[model samples]
Target chain A: MVAKRIIPCLDVDAGRVVKGIQFQHLKDAGDPVQQARRYRDEGADELVFLDITASVEKRKTLVEMVQKVARTLDIPFTVGGGIRTLDDARAILSSGADKISVNTAAVQRPEFIAELADMFGTQCVVLAIDAKRRLGRGNRRAETGERAANVESDIAREASPTGDPEVWFEVYTYGGRRPTGRDALAWAAEAERLGAGELLVTSIDRDGTETGYDVDLLAALAARVNLPIIASGGCGRPEHIYEAFVRGRADAALAASIFHFHRYPIPVVKRFLRQRGIEVRP
Target chain B: MMTRILILDYGVGNLFSLMSAIQREGAEPLIRQEIPPDPCFDGLILPGVGHFTPVSERLRRMRSAIDEVIERGTPILGVCLGMQVLFDRSEEGPGQGLGLIPGAVVRLPDSVKIPHMGWNRLHLVRSNPLLHGVPQGAWVYFVHSFYPQPEDESVVLARAEHGVSFPAVVGRDRIFGTQFHPEKSGEAGSLMLKNFLRLCRG
Candidate 1:
C-alpha cells in the first residue's frame, strides 16, 4: 500500500530560500541545500522547491540553486514556479529534481502538460491549482464592500444563478492574484482528464495563515477528483496534518510556514502520524 | 585503493544521482562520456534515459570501447534505457541493441499506462548472488514506457507487475540489467547497489 506523504515546501527567490505572507513580503530563510538536508534527516517524505522568482530575469539562479540542493539531498524533491516550457522542465529534471510542478504555464497551454507527461512520465508532472471562493451576489457586499444592486433586472439575474454555490470555487492564476472565473472543481477534473497524475490544491484564503487547512474545501474537491490530492495551506500543527488526512481525505499534506519556522520537525510529525495509525513511509 | 565503478554516459540520462549513489555505497564512481581505451575500473554501469532509438545509436557508435570493457568480464549493470539496449532489438526505435542478452525490447501493452512510473514491489524469481541479502518483495522505483522481454526466462532474476507481470531484473553471469533505477530507489535501492558492488570483490 502507498503511504501518505509529508512534504515540506521551500519558496526560493534569487537563489535563496524565502517565505512570505500570501506570496508577498518575502523574508530570507536560509540556504536551500542546508534546509533540504535538514528536512531529509527529519524524515520528510518529499520536498517541494518553488522558484517564486523564476519569472523574473534572475531565472538561471533557480537552476543553480536546485542543482545545489539536489547534490546534498538523497530524497525526492519537486521544483515548481515559472516552469513555462518543456525545456524548462527538462532543465529542472536534469538538475536532479524528481518531479516538476506547473501552474500558470499549464493553465495557459494545456497541451504542454500532456507533452510533459509524455516526455517525463505522468508521475513526474504535478499540476498545482490555486483557488478562492467566488463572491456570490448575496455575499458580494460582504467581501468587496460593493453596494447591493436594487435594479429589477439585476435582481432577476441574481435570483437564478447558473450553477450551485458549491461549484463556484473560482480558479486564480499568478499566485491567486488573477481570477480566471473558471470553476475550481471543474478545472481539477479537467486536469486529471488531461493526464495529470497528481493534484496540488492550495487555498488562497488559508495560505500562510497557519490557522488550519480549509477542511470543507479540500474534502469537497477530494471527493470530486480521483487522483492523489496534496493539500496545501494553513498547516500550523501536527493535528492539522492529521485532520487533512482523516477529514480532508488528502493523500499528502504540504506545509511551508510551520516547517520553515521550525515550529514542527518532519520526523516528529511522521512519528505522531504513525502512532495515530496513519501509514507513512519512515 | 577502493574499487572504482565506471558509469558509461552516452549523453542520454542524468548521472549525478547515479554517481552519488555509488559513492554512498563506499565506491568511487568515474563517469565517462565516451568509453575509455584502457578501462581502469572494477565494475561498469551503463546508465541511459529517454527514447531507445537514440540511446541504441549512441551505444553502437561507441561499440568498440563498450565491447572492450565487457570482454574484460567487468561486472556491468544497465539501467532503464540502458537495460533495453542490452537486448537483441527494440520495437521502440529502428536500432538493434548490443545483443548482450537474447531478448527484444518492446513497448508495454496499451492496457497499462504508457510510462509505468512509481514504486512497485519486486518479486524475486531466480536467486542470484548479485541480489544476495536483498529482501523479497522490496519496492523499487520505475519510470519507463518500454521493458525488455528476454527470450530465455532463466536470466530473469526478478519480476514486477503493472498490468501484467514482466521481467524487472535480468542477468547472465557478469552482465546485469534492471528496468528500474536503483540509484533513485532510496534505501532499498542503495542496498541493491551495495550487493552489486560486493560482486566486484570476487
Candidate 2:
C-alpha cells in the first residue's frame, strides 16, 4: 500500500524561508537549506519550495538557493513559482528538484501543463491549483455555511446538469492574488487530461490559517480525478492532517505553518497519524 | 579505491537526486549521455523521468555499448522508466527496450491511481545482492504509470501491489532493476544503493 505522505512546504522569499497568512503579511521563518534539512531529519516524506517572491516580484526562483536545499536531502523535492516557461522549469529541475509545479502560468495557458508534461514526462509535472470557495450567489452553501452531506453530494453538485453549482471552488492564480473564475474541480479534471501526474490543490481561503484543509475541495477533486491529490492550506494540527487523509481522501497532506513554527513536528504528526491507524512511513 | 558509478543522463529528467544519493553512499557519480566504451566505472545507472518512446529511442542508440558493459560483468541498475527500458518493450509507447531483461512493460491496473505515486512496501521474493540490508516489506517511493512484467518469474526478487501484485525489484546475475526510485525512497533506498555499491566493489 502507498503510505500517506507528509510534505513540508517552505514558502521562500528571495531565498529565505517565509510563512504568510493567506499569502500576505510574510514573516521570515528560517534559512531554506537549514529548514529543508531539518524537515528531512524530522522524517518528512517530501519537501516543496515555493519561491513566493518570484512570480509577484518578477524575479526568478533562486536557483542557488534551490541547489543548496536540494543537496541536503535524499527525498523527493518539488519547486514552484516563477516557472513560466520550460527553460525556467529546467533550471529548477537541473538544480536538483525532482518535480516542478506551475500555477499562475498554467492557469493563464492551460496548454502549458501539457507542454511541461510532454517535455518532462507527466510524472515530474505537478499542477498546483490555488482555489477559494466562491461565496457569491451561485455558491449559496458557502454563504449560508451549509456543508454538503458528504463527498457524494459535492460530486453530484459539481456534475449537476444545470452546470451552475450552488457551491463551487474558484481557482486562483498569482499566488492567490487573482481569481481565475475557473471551477477548481473542473480545472483539476482538465489538468489530469492534460497529463499532469499529480495535483497540488491549495485552498487559498484557508491558507496559513492553520484552521484545517478544505476537505470538501479535496474530497470533491479526489472524486473527480484519478490523479493523486496533495491537500494544502490550513492544517493547524495533526488531526487536521488526518482529516485531510481520511475525510479529504488526499494522498498527501502539505503543511507549512505547523511544521515551520514547531507547533507539530513531523514525527509527532506521523506518530499521531500512525496511532490513528493511518499508514505512514516509519 | 572509491567506486565510480556512471549515470546515463539521456537528457530525460533530474539526475541530481540519484547522483547526490550515490555520492552520499561513498560513490563518485559521473554523468554522461553515452555509456563509456570501457567498463571504467564499477557500476552504471540508467536514470529515468521521461516518456517511454523517447527514452527507449535514446537508450537503443547505446544498446551495443550497454550490452558490452553487461558483458564485462559491470552491474547496471535501471530505475523507474529506466527499469522499464530493461525489458523488450513497453506499452507506454512504441519503442524497443534494451531487452537485457526478457520482459515487456505494461500499464498498472486502473483500479489504483495511474501514476501510483507514493511510498509502498516491498514484499521480498528471493534474496539477491541488491536486497542485502533491505528489510522485508520495506517501503520505497514510486512514480510511474507502467511496470515491467518479466517473462521469467525467477528474475523477480521482490514485489509490490498497487491494485495488483507486480514485480518491484528484479535481478538476474549482475543486471538489476527497481520499479521504485530508490534514490528518493529515504533510508531503505539508501541501503539498496549501498548494496549495489557493494556489488560494484567486488
Q: Number of the top candidate by lDDT?
A: 2
TM-score of chain A of 2: 0.89
| Candidate 1 local lDDT, B1-202, one digit each (tens) | 8979998876644567778778878999998888778767889888856567777888889888777777887788998887889998988779888898998988776665445655667889989977787788876777676788999999999998877788999999899999888886766677879988988765
Q: DockQ, per-model, please? A: 0.20, 0.76
**Per-residue accuracy of model 2 over A1-282 as CA lDDT, tens digit each:** 899999999888888888878888888898888888889889898999888775444454488887777677878889988789998888888888989999988877788999999988898899999988765434433322212233234444465312344557877788888765566776788789998989999998888788899898888888899999999999899999999999899999999888888989999999999999999998
The collision pairs in model 2 are none
Could you give the CAPRI-style class of model 2?
A: medium
Evaluated at residue A7, the lDDT of candidate 2 is 97
lDDT tens per residue, model 1, A78-121: 89998989888988887878788998877777788888866765
i-RMS for every candidate: 3.7, 1.1
What C-alpha lDDT values do all the predictions have? Answer: 0.78, 0.86
- By summed lDDT, the worst window of 10 consecutive residues in model 1 chain A runs over A144-153
